[model samples]
Every structure is written in C-alpha cells, then in structure tokens.
Target: MKKIILLCLTIVLYNCNGNAQKTAQKTEQKAYKVSKTDSEWKAQLSKMEYYVLRKAGTERPFSSPLNKNYKAGTYVCAACNTPLFKSEHKFDSGTGWPSFDREIKGHVAFGSDNKLGYSRDEEHCATCGGHLGHVFNDGPINTTGKRHCINGVALKFIPKE
Candidate 1:
C-alpha cells in the first residue's frame, strides 16, 4: 500500500510542469496586416470600444443600439475599418448582440477559445486581430448555420451608398 501511494504521488507530480499551463495562451501570436501600438488603439477607440475590441471584453446585453438596427449597411471592424459582415447576413438573433449568419470570407480569422472552460470558436479581424466575438453552430438552417455573435462596439456600421 505504501509503494502504491508513492507511485501515485510521483505520477501526479510528473504530470505537472512546475505550475505551467498546458494550453490556452500561446507564446507567439499570429501576425496581422494592420498592427498598432497599445496607446494608438486606446486613443482611436472609445472606452467601450476599446474594452470589447482590444481587451476581449463583452458589453452589456441590449445596451448597444446596433442590436436593434435594421439598416441596409455593412459592418466593418471598428479597429481597422475592414469590411467584415454585410447587411444581408445580419440577423436578429434575439441574443442582444449584433449577430450575423456569415462573414466576408477570408476577412475574418478563427481561433480556439477555452476561457469558458468548454471550447468555443473565437473570431477576430484578420487584418487587425481585433476581438470580434465567438461563433456558434446555431444559426439559420437555410444559411451557413453559423451564428457569429459579435460585439457591437467592435464594429462600425457603414450605410450603403
């Protein structure tokens, strides 16, 4: 029994890496076409926008006026003005955030986020690496079946001309 207990303890200790985490935050980040200094981003974005786009924070549900906006326009990255979701893809998800069925292909990048314990698909502006939000499998069946639940502050509405 003593030997068995010692073996178990050794195995547990061996599995740990001196408090280092096994995953989540990566050592190096992918390069983006539009990069800016921390100060620049803070200066350009509003307080709430900075929180959502740069800090990966969520805004209060139903707080964003864009949530109920039904205008025909394009949604661009608030950080870099990169066109992301089109007006045609926008949908009222009843989720309080500006939801979209799809993004302009190749403009948005996908990453893994396990911050919520379970894994979630993370979205970012491919050009600026701004935190847009998460994408889920739940969406219109006739469409792409992707619900890109994005933060409104992370986006800017551009009316069609």
Candidate 2:
C-alpha cells in the first residue's frame, strides 16, 4: 500500500503543474516595449497588483472599485502605464472585474489559458507584458461582441482632462 501511495504521489507531483509559470512563459519569447526585472516589478507594484499582473492570478469578482466606474477616462497598465482601454468601451458584464467592449488598438495582447481544465482567452499588456485578464465572446450586441474582462489591479484609471 505504501509503495502504491508513493507512486501515485510521485505521478501527481510530476504531471500536475501549477499556474505559476503560465504568464511568464507566454512573455518569455515575446519582447515587450517596457521590460522590467522581477524585483523592479515587485518594488513598484502593490502586493495585489504583483499577484494579478506578474503571476497571472485572478482577483475576486466585484472586488475591484474600477468595476463600477463610469467616468470618462482611460485605463492604463498598472505596471507600465501603457494605455490599454477607454471608458467609452467599458460596460457592466456582471461577472465582476472591469469589463470593456474593446481595447485601445495595439495596446493589449492575447494568449491562451488552460489552467481551468479548459481553454480560455487570456489577455495582457502589450507594452510590458503584464497579465491583465481574460477576454470572452459574451459581450454586448451591436458592438465589438468581445468582452475584455480585465483585472482592476492590473489597471489604473486616468480621468480625462
């Protein structure tokens, strides 16, 4: 019984990989306009921002204050300050996090996420490669038909002047 248990544990440990490298791996091969060392990122970002951006971790739904924001402004990358989304494209997806109908052209990048035993469309900042969040097809009609569900921690809103 002990031998079998050990074998099972070994197999589980060897085959099941965590989501730790999910974002990092995706950014490694692609170069971003704004690059920073891990230490630099940690020093600059808050703990929650670091977790959501660098580690590709998800923030709790409806937890972000930005989710309810409806002001005119722009959402920029929290890590690199790269402009990503506009308030005009924002919407209430009710899935929490800040949902947008679209992104600022050329500011966001897309990738694949399979951490949940299925495939998901992941998004990140094209400027710094910071993990933003995932995009889904279930969005408002008569528009882009794409929901860019982004992590608020990964963004900082700059009100229009």
Candidate 3:
C-alpha cells in the first residue's frame, strides 16, 4: 500500500511539472504590426520601460504617477504609440496601478497568463506587442465592471490640449 501511494504521488507531481513547463513554452506565435529587434527596443525604451514592456514585468503598486493622474487625455503604447485607454475609462481602483474600465477598440490584445500560479487575462499592445498589465472582474459596478490594471511604464499619457 505504501509503495502504491508513493508511486501515485510521483506520477502526479511529474505531470504537474510537465504541464507547467508546457505552459511556459507556449510563446506568442503571432507577429505584431510593429516588431523590433531587442537592441532596437532597448534603444527606444527606457530601462524600466524595457523591463515592463518586453519582459512582462510588473511595476510596484502605487508606484506609477499615472495612477493619480486624473487629467483628460489618451494613453498610448510606450513602444509603438498606439492609443489604448481613454481618460474617460480611467478609474481609481486603489490597486497601486493605473486602472481603466475599458480600452480603445482594437488597440489592446488579451491572452492567458499562468505565470503567477493562476490564470490571468494579460493585456498587450496590439501594435507592438508590449506588455501592459492584467484585467480583473472586480471593478465599479455602475461602469463596465472590468478593472484594467496597467503599468505606467508601458504607456505614455497624452494630455488633451
């Protein structure tokens, strides 16, 4: 009985490890409209921007000035300047990052991310494929009820003139 239990545990652990590896191996196969070489991207983006946009890194909560920004304007992709979230959809979710209820139509793309040991809807720039952030269902009930938590380093705030 002990041997059988040990063998079953081993098999289950191995399968779980393999599944995690497989999930990590699934890269973004689709090409973006504004693809660039690593060096080119490094040259165009700041160190922090490169880290968050290219490496799928997250900024510390409440670390982005954009989180407190309430000016009216549009937020564009830091990499390719593609307009993403509008100021109208911006909200304060108090999650320490810029929160939005919606994004510009056809500007942001969604994909499954299991990097944090759970499934999350990851957002990226449709034009440059830059990592933006994650979206959650807990948002303002009167609004779209979607919280688009974005990294400030991944966006450029273009204030309305």
Candidate 4:
C-alpha cells in the first residue's frame, strides 16, 4: 500500500513539472521583447492610449471615443502594428466596449483567460502577445455568440480613404 502511494505521488509531481515546462514554453513563444522605450511609446500614443495599451490597463466601459466608430477600416495592433480586426467584424456589443466577431487571419491569437476567475477567451496580438481583451459567448445570436471585447487603446483604426 505504501509503495502504491509513493508511485502515485511521483506521477503527480512528474505531471506537474511537465505542465509547468509546457506553460513556460508557450509563454516564451508568445512574449514580445520590448524594443521601444516608454518615452517612445508615449510619443507614439496619446496619454490614454499609452495607459491602456502599454500598461495593460482597461478603459471604462462605454467611454471610448471609438465605441461608435462604424467606418470601414482596419484595426491594427497598437504595439506591433499588426492588422488584427477588419471593419466588417466590428460590432457594438452594447457592453460599452469595442467588440469584434472575427479577426484577421494570423494576426490575433486566443487563449483561455481566467483573469476574473471565470473561463473566457483572452485576445492578444499574435505577433506581440499584447493583451487586447477577453471574449465572451454573449454576443449577437445571428452571428456566433463570440464577443471579442477589445480595449480601444490596443487598436489603431485605419479608415479606408
């Protein structure tokens, strides 16, 4: 009986170590090395944008100037300048945040987010791993229930001329 218990403990520890290693590897692949200084980012972004994008802060819901921006444009990553969301995907989720139903292929990555102690999809810049926001399953039923709640500061809208 003691031998069996010892074997189980060993297996649990081994699995835990394996999981930790895998998590580390995944983080390494997703992390973006900062090449720009804080001053540089500040210069490139407005004070509010810098606060949300660079500092990983969230803006108050329904307060963003872009919440109602319904123009045709491409939404790009504020950090790495990668195009992530298309105008067609943008929708008003009525949650006071910029919502998208889809993203440009290969530009955004989704991961399980438990930031608020609940399971949700966390959206990030695929190339830069910058935190954009979380996704939920409470969006429009005509489309998928997926609501990609994005931080305005994490995006740059480029309107088509």
Q: Which parts of model 2 have CA positions greater than 4 angstroms off?
A: 1-28
Clashes of each: 0, 0, 1, 1
Q: Which predicted model would earn the best lDDT? A: 3
Error of 2 at 39 (Å): 1.0
What lDDT tens digits, residue by residue, belong to model 1 across residues 1-161?
A: 99999999998897775435544345557889999889999999999998988888999988888898889999999999999999999999999999999999999999888888999999999999999999999988899999999999899999998
Give the Å shift of residue 46 in candidate 3. 0.8
lDDT for position 157 in model 2: 96
Task: Give the worst 10-residue stretch by lDDT in candidate 4.
Answer: 28-37
Supply the global lDDT for candidate 3. 0.94
Candidate 2 worst ten-residue window by lDDT: 15-24
lDDT for each residue of candidate 4 in 12-126, tens digit (9 for 90 to 100): 9999999999899678644454456678888987777777766667889988777899999898887778899888888988888899987787877887756678887778788
Off by over 4 Å in 4: 1-47
Q: What is the lDDT of residue 129 in candidate 3?
A: 92
The residue pairs in collision within model 4 are 62-96
Question: How does each model score on lDDT?
Answer: 0.91, 0.92, 0.94, 0.81
What is the C-alpha local distance difference test score of candidate 1? 0.91
lDDT of 2 by residue, 1-161 (tens): 99999999988876666444566676778888888899999999999999999999999999999999999999999998999999999999999889999999899999999999999999999989999999999999889899999999999999999
Candidate 1 similarity to native, TM-score = 0.88
**Cα error of candidate 4 at position 1, Å:** 20
